[model samples]
Target: MANASSAATLSICSSSSSSFFSHIPTRVPSQFSFNHQKPKCRLLTIRAAVYTAPSPTPMPAASSSGIVLVDKSDSDKVNRLKSVYLEKIVPILKEEFGYNNIHEVPGIEKIVVNCGMGDAEQNSKGLEATIKDLSLITGQRPVKTRAKKSIASFKLREGTTVGIAVTLRGNVMYSFLDRLINLGFPRTRDFQGVNPNSFDGHGNYSIGMRDQSVFPEIRYEALGKTRGMDVCITTSANTDNEAQRLLALLGMPFKEGAGPTVLLRRKRKKAHHFDSKIKGKK
Candidate 1:
């Protein structure tokens, strides 16, 4: 009777254990896994901490491209040359020179400013000062001109930088010419106007300045030594006469009755006077 009671108690304990184990979950959900088979590539979904509206800001308009419309503006000012050309020059060209087409009217193409750096080869300060003054005057940096061939007599070596030059075009060229004509020429010592015969017969005029100090760009005290420069103005005209007329109309301040024509007339008058005196003596 004792053995049977013991056996029955053991069976009851085993059944209770089996029931408890069955109630427990044996498999984990896919969300939480420790198995490392072929790894899954799942994108994580995250929500923002704060709520905000989706608004796109507008951008500024892009600049118009092309050669002609680059600097076009409502506030664009007509400079002295352009003003005179439109108001006075065009009509004069049409009436006096028989220029029927607007394109035939002479206009300035460019202005070239050059300075010799012969002294700069010896002193670095000279080049610096020249560059500074030139940049101030032209509102542009200069390109150094180098010697192509060595010259033993002048002690110049090949590839040696001997000069600096700046080419002015568009508005800068016009402004420079305006200043040169209105202010620079008047400030020159003795104040003789530019030579009319300096035109290269192809609508280009070259003028030489003996002293750069004449320009307001160069301060007298700051200069170590005086320097000279050359100014070359190129025009779209076909001939020297047309370019000369264009320049004069644009206020170049050419000397009155001091040109080659005037000189020739004077020479003819002298010759005639001499001939009359000889006839009287006879």
Candidate 2:
């Protein structure tokens, strides 16, 4: 009985040891295996995306052919002063001047408006104001005139802006002249006729205004300073006589006892005196 009991106890101990060994795995399963060559390392190259801006679209080039088209309807319409010149002034000039061809009759070419700023070096604002006032008066932009050379006596420097000027031609010239003759001159205080002797030897006439206030365009209250202006009327005439006649016919008021006849007489006297002097010298 003791030997059978010992055998039973030995069997039971071996069975319990085998069950414990079964519970704890001796070899890892295929799912958890570390022998699969580490998935070949794969060097995961994470390519970062870079942003780029698109190029601007090119603009269409302008037409190289410099052809300019004019409107016929607009060209047909004549300016007020232009029509007057064609209809009335042309015939009058032809008859009076004994002009065989109508083309020979002299006409106004252009008008130049100038404003000199004597104190431009000292006062820049005055220069600016003069430019503004001139533009207002002329209905065109005035170009700033600069000193060509430095003048110590006048305190002027080279390239210093000392004046402003505007040149008017075509319909604009006629319009401005008409306005100046009819409106501007009449508006002056203690108004008198323009100087008849203001003609240059080269058939150009000049008129000086004391201030720009005479023009309807300028506002007296808005003006910073009283500015003077010079108006030079250039003509296609051959002589001062022709130019004077042309201007007088176009409604330039001359002072009493100072007309083209007087100018002609003065010129004749000067020529006669010059001739006499030459004879005496001989």
Q: Estimate each model's TM-score.
A: 0.63, 0.63
Off by over 4 Å in 2: 1-78, 260-282
Q: Candidate 1 lDDT, tens digit per residue, 63-151?
A: 23100111233125657566556655667666768977888888888999999878667788779878889998888999899999999
> Residue 83 in model 2: shift from native, Å?
1.6
- The digit string of per-residue lDDT tens for model 2 on 18-93 reads 9989899788898888775655566789999988889883322212321112234323555665666675567767
lDDT of each: 0.77, 0.78
TM-score of 1: 0.63
* Residue 48 lDDT, candidate 1, scale 0-100: 78
lDDT of 1: 0.77
